[model samples]
Target: MVNRVEVFAAIRRDARVEGMSIRALAEKHGVHRRTVRQALEGAEPPPRKTPVRMSPRLAPFKSAIDEMLTCDLDAPRKQRHTARRVHVRLIEEHAATNLSYSTVRDYVRVRRAQIDLAAGRRNEVMVPQEHAPAAEAEVDFGEVYVILAGVKTKCRMFTFRLSYSGKAIHRVYATEGQEAFLEGHIDAFNEIGGIPTRHIRYDNLTSAVSKVVVARGHDPARDRVENSRWLLFRSHYGFDAFYCQPGIAGAHEKGGVEGEVGRFRRTHLVPMPVVDSLDELNEKIREWDLADERRRINDRIRTVADDFAQERQLLAPVPVEGFEPGLILTPRVDRSSLITVRMARYSVPARFIHRRVRVSLRASEVVVFDPDKSGRTQIARHPRVVTKGGQCVDLDHYLEVLKGKPGALPGSTALAQARASGVFTAAHEAFWANARRRLGDADGTRELIDVLLLHRHLPAAAVEAGLTAAISVGATSADVVALEARLHLAKTDAIAVVEHAGAVGGAGSGRHLVAQRHLDEQQDVARDVVAEARRRKVVSLTERLLLDPAAVIAGLPPDTRPLPSVEKYDQLLRLRTGTDNHPAPPTEQARPARPALSVEETP
Candidate 1:
């Protein structure tokens, strides 16, 4: 009730300035004898500390309100009691009507803060955290925009960071789907040469989580369930996983990768790179990644690459088999040699039409295979297009059907694509014009189809070169085109032999002899093919095997017949020597015994 400063000042004035005696000051100040003695001895009086006052009316109520507030720590914020609720409960539960509502309200406010402090609800201050080398890492997806194929498109960068070394791996994807998520992990691990730690941290992404069922007041680990595919992937890589709290609360948990994605994007992907395809964009990204090895992170003397080099030994060795981050689908090939996957059409071989085939769909490519074969035969393959309703056609798949319907060759989609792809080159166009002059349109297109079919077994560039050579030599027949194509191809296909400083006398002589022999054989085959073409004789491919050795060899049946048994020779030896010493061997199947006759009886 009294100000300590003012009281001290009064003691000083009365004792020093007014010249009051100790007894007089005590009476004037209405103070104790000791207080007056202290005031007279010193210029100022020392203030006393007030004792903590206990409230009699609210003593019992304090415990009750504290009990309620303690549970409120875990209870929903909106469901917790207000001051009015506490006051009403006090009167009803403890018969505390004598206590005023304002007294309880004011007391409850201060008490709540004290209880919260006791319950670990104080304001936080962050301290530097140290990570164990190769013991932990973080994973996250960051969104970035770049000009892809001249179109500004949104993309996601899947980033993985080793917390201790500050080394990170990043891969860009069109979507952050589960396949991309798992594939990124595989690729990142491979780039690092091993898997970092056993535990990887994530931010409750749907790719890894099936559902986050619990909101508040529940443990995060118990509330969320891991996706089955994701679990299998983790098991395959032999790694444990941890999830961060939802939203911004968990941002600090995986802060390493969080900062890495932004830093990498700003440093490398800033100028909005324009690339024709994802492969091109990835190639640029790869170059930047390799070049980034020279830069250091923060004040560290060692570069990121240097730290990664040290950390590589601490990481777990990769598994024997790598995981295929792809979705398997069984799609039926359509009549047009096309199969629709994710609403996009990809062409397969026409022979597989109406048959179900297996498709391996990755982030940027689709590979189709014949299901009956154990992945030995790949029917068709195409780069995946991000946009729906896109179609990728391979002209070779339609060659056989085009051969029968040569009239459809001009207006067909396959022809247009072939022309654009340079598969149907200028040489082919020139040859076609010449063929049309010699033969009619129907016959000319058939010859073109024959040249196109050569592409199936040989490279298109070699075929185009052969067409150029054939056109130069004034050869209009398809057999001449085939012969010229083979000649150009043998030289192109020959393996390059590098000459060392000290070489043998004839290192490449064998290769030169092989090429000359191939040329002579091709010339003979060409003469036979031309003779067959010039005449009107209708010959099936099987009948003309004498012309093409490769077709003949391929058409030959397997030599599955059994060889004569050694028992027959044994019997001949016994009969010639007239010695019955060796016993006849038992046979697997029953046969009738032949009647014996003397050699001279018939004569």
Candidate 2:
């Protein structure tokens, strides 16, 4: 193997303004040909190792710590004790050490038994026995790269693994926001078929934690807890929650889910899982988690799924319907009577503009439930915007209000921009007409109305400029029209040419053209006849045929009556025949004719 130093040295020696063969350099330096070539190609040499020394202050405790760690090779990792804890113990009890904590920790870590504990592995192991009733589940978030909707979207998967059964539930979401966090819990509980007995465990995530206590001389107990607020919400669904210390490294009580979260990400979400959509991807993740629950453990009698099944009965029953998780906020409507929720704007009636509205937001949608308690009416609904740190407002809602106020049009920047951009079609003119009717003489209404035109162009920007110019010069609509004509004349020239060529001869050049002109003149008469026939056909087929069959039958007595003698039948059939043979015996002749009724003559 060629060392980096040798390869780099060879390239430098050969580079002295005179090139040398990389292969020859490799032979001379005793480095691999590829290494020499890479060096010559401007690759940096590998970094040199720097020697680090143990902190001398803690040298004395190193050996003792190492021995203790090795002695407890089979003990649980939490029981083995870290060097920092050991050093603290030494100072507190033995009163013995000039030793620094770092030196002792490094020595013990290196010399400790390499025994692989099941708990230490990233993979989760099944609990050896059935969990006690009411044991809480620990929840956490893990990040994994997944392909969603054809883009490599970074998604955070929420993991909730039971402390007793080792059963893990997972869901992937676009964010780790509060909605995702709370919704994940609800879904996981539903999958487990019950809520945990007493409380659910969680790290000091912002969703649950309001404060972190770091008092000296005392173990941190996540205090200032807002359990009431959470419980107020959760109480509706039924679940108790407990939080772990903010930054503790203890694993005896809280490490189960930490390892499980990592295991799920690596085993199920890594190396690129492709899905058609986020929902599909989440469904795949859920299936994988459920499948994981079915695997048997080496030391456990039942699988994770089986253990969870046993614990299900002990869990609290969920509410009749689950509580929807969301962030609640209040926002005031703007002068436009529009409230901006989740970046997309929605509007109340103009009467309510500037009034405060309550918004109930969810993961996928923003529901503007009726603010007044009169009834269960929804003011508006908009798709939830998930893009971080931005506001999304639906401009269409305000457009509806603007439709009622035509006078507000001129000042509407949106409408002005639209007009300049050529977005105003004939439909926009009709909308403008309607708006003007609704909002006569109201300047504010006009301004709002102009906003509708912001995205349209009818009068091109140049035309608008010309109109504005005319208006500035105190020109009326007639004056503006005259100015437009003058501008059009000034920018364009009329062309004239004399045509002496006689008409050409073709299939339709002479007679066909005259005939076409005649046909066009008679089009109205032809159209009325065709329309009447179509109307009659529709009535006969759909309504009259159904409502009064006898009336239709009376109108067409010949069609409904039994066939007359062969002579009459042949005459009617002749109308359908195309100058060929008489219409063949009605295919019904294949069956015997009904027996002639016995003569009841005179009776």
Candidate 3:
């Protein structure tokens, strides 16, 4: 409660003005003769010297603890010992029963610092820095936690901050992989409308640096063997990369972004965002970035946006053509019709099994492309799984395979996912149940699979509507489902066609009469009692069942012919001009002579 400096002043004043003896001053001020002598010598008291007290209990274990601490210098920084660990070890190993933990902790703290100092390690020395407009920027990834879909998930926050303006762009990703890294840069560049003219500072992230060539007396610039993809990306964007020295030495190289990451996290991401998906989290981050532009960092006179405005014009314009940030991969599909990408599995079409397919692994999605003479065509796309061993499967991808092994359909992971995602709707469940009950499981599931295959061509809504129509009519056949789905599609097409005809008819030209006649025909069909309810502007079919189900069902005649077989038509695909199997019809002149001779012989 008392100030030591004030006490010393009082003692010195009393000694001088009262002319008190050392004993008298000691009695009056509650001070010792040594303290009185110190006060008399100078107004400011000399610091008290710490006593070299002996620790009798701790003496026996000192060597062991010292050896442990000394050896920790060679161990990993994360694995090094703390005061509590040393105390525990002493209690467990040395059996120093009477020793207090505080005693060991105090000694360990002082001794560790001394040991580090002795080993030529000291606190880092930091100096002030100045940044020029549009000159430099820093890139870094910081860990962030979010409650995604009611589950606690760890995510990475990519921050790109301009040194001069303190203006930053932030995006959250599922992983800190090269795809996310490159995408973060692309997003920052596009958002800022330009790139930093000078080199950008970066830590030696594995995404950019494949190998760090650490050699004595070598330039840090050439020390890194940049990743080929990263080099190509940087070259496309027209920017230079300045890699920091590895480890602690490089931490301070990008201090601006390092501090920015923490500042943004503490200020905006404090509550640990609750989001349904990563895109939702990033949407929040984008809003925060915009709000931060109006803020002032530390004690600056101008806001971040104000400073950025002046710096914006100085920055180099973004390149006209942008670069693809997704990492390209080629993975062979297994028997399960799944391809493994970055330890995660995603389903492609069953036709691609045992075949290598090109994948563009982006931050949020994986795109599979099938390359042919016609060039690459995207066959499947799924959300990228964040965790290792995770899978993203589409039930439609394995329809053909499931058709052969209908027993596997009920227990398949893809089917489970489809049910979870509402892709397999109640109508589908109802239809499958009916089919299984009527046709038995094996044949019934095959029918369901056939109906499922229609989803590849028809809209899911149409297929779901078709299922409902079939269930209402007590139709267990996949053909009925296909026919209803096709009818639903026809209705949609008719509506579009009618609208287009109406627009064309407004031209009031003679040629418009054709469209008008088609429109009139469609109207006449709608007015007909048989098709009246089928041609209305309807809501989503998945949300509503068809009107007049009994009437439509009764109007449907029993189909004896197999459902629209195209198997025979496939032969026409291999059209041969002149082959023994199917020679083209002989010309009349060419066949006439042979025909005349054959007829005379027959007569």
Candidate 3 whole-model C-alpha lDDT, 0 to 1: 0.86
Error of 3 at 48 (Å): 11
What is the C-alpha lDDT profile of model 2 across 555-582, one tens digit per residue? Answer: 7646566765677667777777755476
**After superposition, which runs of candidate 1 have C-alpha atoms over 4 Å from their true positions?**
1-125, 215-217, 493-495, 498-603
How close is each model in CA RMSD to the real structure?
16.8, 25.2, 10.4
Q: Compose the digit string of candidate 3's lDDT tens values, residues 55-131.
A: 89888888988888898879988999999999988889888889899999989998898788787666667888999
**TM-score for each predicted model, relative to the true structure:** 0.63, 0.45, 0.67
User: What lDDT score belongs to each candidate, Candidate 1 first?
Assistant: 0.79, 0.62, 0.86
Q: After best superposition, candidate 1 residue 454: deviation in angstroms?
A: 1.6
Best-fitting candidate, scored by TM-score: 3
| Candidate 1 residue 553 C-alpha distance from true site, Å | 35
Best of the candidates, lDDT: 3
Residue 360 lDDT, candidate 1, scale 0-100: 86
TM-score order, best first, reads 3, 1, 2
Error of 3 at 389 (Å): 3.3
Q: What's model 2's lDDT at 144?
A: 81
Q: How many backbone clashes does candidate 2 have?
A: 34
